[model samples]
Structures are given as structure tokens and as C-alpha cells.
Target: MSDLLRLLPWSGPDGRRCYVSADSGGGPVSRLADRLEELQLDTGAELLDHVEELLRAHRVSGDELRFCVHRLAEALRDALRVAESRGRRIPVPEDEMEDEMEGHPEPPGLC
Candidate 1:
């Protein structure tokens, strides 16, 4: 018997993180979470494209920009949580990784 739990992407209205117990992370609910995460990431990408186009326009209203940013942030949070539940880190660019590692070398023998 395993008591492992996976964190769901969305939190409760009370601001508490929600979790679902699964013997492994491949159960039905886990699969649903994975799908939702993918959808969120796709939505976020679309929103980013919209933001880029809006920025290129001669004039974009403050409210429109704010709404786009808020939605994009929400989608990003969902995608991040999904990755975390799967015990994976979102891939970072190699240059960014090197910058992060600078002055933060891994302990010897602990690669």
C-alpha cells in the first residue's frame, strides 16, 4: 500500500493546496491532471502570442494588457504545478542553467 499523493493544479477557494492520493502518478485522476496541464500550457502560449501582437500595435489599453498578463500567469502556475506533481523540473535554457549554477556548484560527489 502506498500513501503517495499528487498535488492538483488548482487550489481550494480557501487558498489551501489540494492533493489526490494515487498508488502511482498514472491513475485516472492523474491523467486528467496531466491533460489539464497541457491545455493550460497551450493556452498560455496563445496568450503570449496575443500579448506580443498587442505590444506591436500602435496602442493597447491598460485593461487589455492587464487581463492578458493575469491569464498568462494563471496558466503558467498550472503548468508548473503539473510538472511538480510528476516529479519533473521544467526544462531551462542551457545558458540560464549555467547562470543559476554560477557560485552554486553542486557538492562534490553529489552531481
Candidate 2:
């Protein structure tokens, strides 16, 4: 395994986060993940537009609201995963990292 560990776009069968080792970002798995990330981001943007329209209606049904919320939750999950994966790849200085760590006593959970 390479020293570079990339958080995968999809989770494991048990719903746990997965990682892949790839020194070069052009590997098949990395390429597939990149495509999936792009799809996720585009889907999130489209979902946001839909949600705005749905919420602006004069009369909104309970079923419609429920469905919207469900899709929003799914989209949020995807967006968060994408953010986390990208965030990890960013280079941060030790002093800045320490400052961030000091502000937050503990790491936040996905929930």
C-alpha cells in the first residue's frame, strides 16, 4: 500500500468509511472516485434548486415535505462525505492544525 491514503467515495457493505492507497491519482479506482465525487456535487447543486422551488410553493403537501426532507438528508450525506474527503487532502500547517484542534475539544461525529 502507498503512503497516500484516499477516502473512497462509497462506503463498505457495512456502511463504514473506506480508504484506498494510490500514490498517483490516475489509477482506475481514483478515476472512478473522482467521477463519483463530481456526480455527487452536481446532484447536490440540483437538489438545492429543487428544494428552493418546493419550499416556495403556496401549498405544500406533507408527503411532499417528507420526500423533500429525505432527499435533502441523502444529499447532505453525500456533500459531507465529499467535503471530508477533499478536506483531508488539503495541506495544513502544524501551528494552524494545533489552533484548530484547540478550538474543538473533540472531533465531530458524522451524525
Best by TM-score: 2
- lDDT against the true structure, per candidate, is 0.71, 0.79
Per-candidate RMSD vs. true structure?
9.0, 4.9
Best by lDDT: 2
Evaluate residue 35 in candidate 2 and report its C-alpha lDDT on the 0 to 100 scale. 98
lDDT of 1 by residue, 17-43 (tens): 767765556788778877877787788
106 in model 1: Cα distance from truth in Å? Answer: 25
lDDT of 1 at 52: 91
Clashes of each: 0, 0
TM-scores, all models, native as reference: 0.65, 0.77
Q: How well does candidate 1 match the true structure in TM-score terms?
A: 0.65
Residue pairs of candidate 1 with colliding backbone atoms: none
